[model samples]
Target: MIPFLSAWPPSPANPTLPADELHVWVASLNRSQTQLNQFWQHLSEDERARANRFYFDHDREHYIVARGLLRQLLGNYLQLPAHLIAFAYGEHGKPELAAEQATSGVRFNISHAQGVALLAFSRNREVGVDIEQVRPLDDGEQIAERFFSENEVAVFTAVPPEQKPQAFFNCWTRKEAFIKVIGEGLSCPLDSFDVTLKPGEPADLLQVKGSREAAARWRLENLEPANGYAGAVIAEGREWQLRTWQWPA
Candidate 1:
């Protein structure tokens, strides 16, 4: 299990992110209206436009908090003001620092579920993070059949009934993290790769269907960001250390 450090200073400071270390920050999306107003200013015009596209106020608020916090966090690392930081997207819409900021060698990915969000950052390598609030699912098997590789489906089917929810999410998060890091999005089928999903089993990228040596190029680590949540982080290469931190630090 990964441990999250809650020792954050109230004011921003330059944090060292070594090339061989990965940082994952956990934050709560729920914020007071005042705090929301402050965070809203951190977003770019394009981001605010995207947030406005959300029909529901709850979703719009969450989007504001997530993107705002993301800018603040990246701002600390880049030593730049949050509002001036720009972003560029990949062919599949995976966001990354603009070329100007990319020179800093910071690569990142973000995911949020329920009221929590996870942001992962690494230097000189791709990184992705995912968090999901565990909940009962009536269609777990049906969804697994549609998305899981053959080996994954068989193992998932044999899990004890009571452990199914956790197992399902464990698999879901790990796979999502992998695809996001690869920047292929769903264009890379979830069923085209395999991951370890058994409760208590170590998180891993087991195989990539056509690439004999692909699985060895990345590493997966399980995360428990908060109660009732399952999270995972993946990054290129296995030589790095994971430093988990809470937001507001």
Candidate 2:
């Protein structure tokens, strides 16, 4: 089983954990081309064609590899058979285990960007995660003005031009993570909440207006995914700890 520590590595004021203990893994989907092709070869012709139709080669490869890694990590940590870990989807396409499995108490969230994917697991809390690549933006300010709350727009407008993309992505991921946590999708207005995501810092909940119960019940974390990506995770409850793990290629 994965090691469980008595306490998490302090807080933002304290140093982050060693890279290894952060439980962050990175895979170069580019490097997995051969393994992906082999996986395809094993599938029936119809299944292969279905994958081709539903996903790009890279996304298909990512799904296959990520699911395998999630199973491996879950099995190692929970001692549960990987095959028995059934999956169900939320109204918004957020994938989760069935009520029976969920009540039995395993929770996880997964997100992928570029060639890398992330998986987070917890035994006693609801979790959700999102990752996005930092891309050049032609009109980030306009987009923020259109979709962000007044306070969020103020924060975005104040960021230096060079830092705007990262700031934008950071906010986007945090919002997505929170939405996913509630399984509410776009039903939650993007402008109704605000998250603080300073560089090299943990995410802080700034403002949440609609559901008082939700705001009080969930904890959100912003992650620095490598150097070029922004990521976030939201977990229900306050007593849980986060432990990131890396996957061996």
Candidate 3:
């Protein structure tokens, strides 16, 4: 059987910022497409086909499951009808709300990689989340040199060779989370931003050009998604807290 993480109630010690504040949810899709068909049936044919175009079958299932979970969670959080929680994607494919909510000013973003998906929501602030499964690399250092900034490449290269893949994924997810929050796609150069993601340390903001002052309003966090993945979230404004819910089977 595919193991899944269930949403646990939050504790006072880990109190949510506010009912209306930012929250993050992570879901695992280790189920077969046939098992996920119940969720898939809710989408229009086009949406289902679009999701299916993803290279991996689990990617398709997780995307659909995450959207359904988002709709249900938004209904409870915003006290809006589930159908009213609409979505519209940006020119570069960043998803946003389609219609204004009665609550007003709520924003969210979603991302998935491997078998995991992440959703981030905030009140009066834009948010983005990204997760990547760390995979074995024959030459992770070489790939970092090709795609990462000179400073980032140097950092990875200095990682004693054994820990380079983890270091590379840490940096990649931070940069991707930030870029995803900016909604600029590849137009926002990766080299323009620098992120600090030293192993066992929290993600720190690094300066980047072309990101609006609005982008600076964001708070980014490195996430621990299950055992094999690295993840991060970028949200507008500081003084925010995150609550993660794992979707049930």
State how far residue 179 of model 3 sits from its true place (Å): 0.7
Highest TM-score model number: 1
lDDT of 1: 0.89
- lDDT of predicted model 3: 0.69
**Could you tell which candidate, 1 or 3, scores higher by TM-score?**
1
Alpha-carbon lDDT of model 2: 0.66
The candidate scoring highest on lDDT is: 1
Give one digit per residue, the lDDT tens place, for model 1 in 18-101.
898898888888888998999999998888999999999989999999999889889888889999889999999999999789
lDDT of 2 by residue, 1-65 (tens): 12222232322322232212223334434445666654444444444465667446667776666
Cα RMSD of predicted structure 1: 3.0
Runs with alpha carbons beyond 4 Å of true place in candidate 2: 1-28, 31-34, 37-50, 210-214
Sort by lDDT, top down from the best: 1, 3, 2
Ranking by TM-score: 1, 3, 2
The CA lDDT of each predicted structure is 0.89, 0.66, 0.69
lDDT of 3 by residue, 1-249 (tens): 323333333322322336346777766656666646655655555666788789976566677776665665666666766545667778998877666663456677777776677777777777777888877688776777676777777767777655666777888888888888889999987777667756777786666664446446767788876677788888767777677766554
Error of 1 at 231 (Å): 0.8
Query: Lowest summed lDDT over 10 consecutive residues: which window, candidate 1?
Result: 1-10
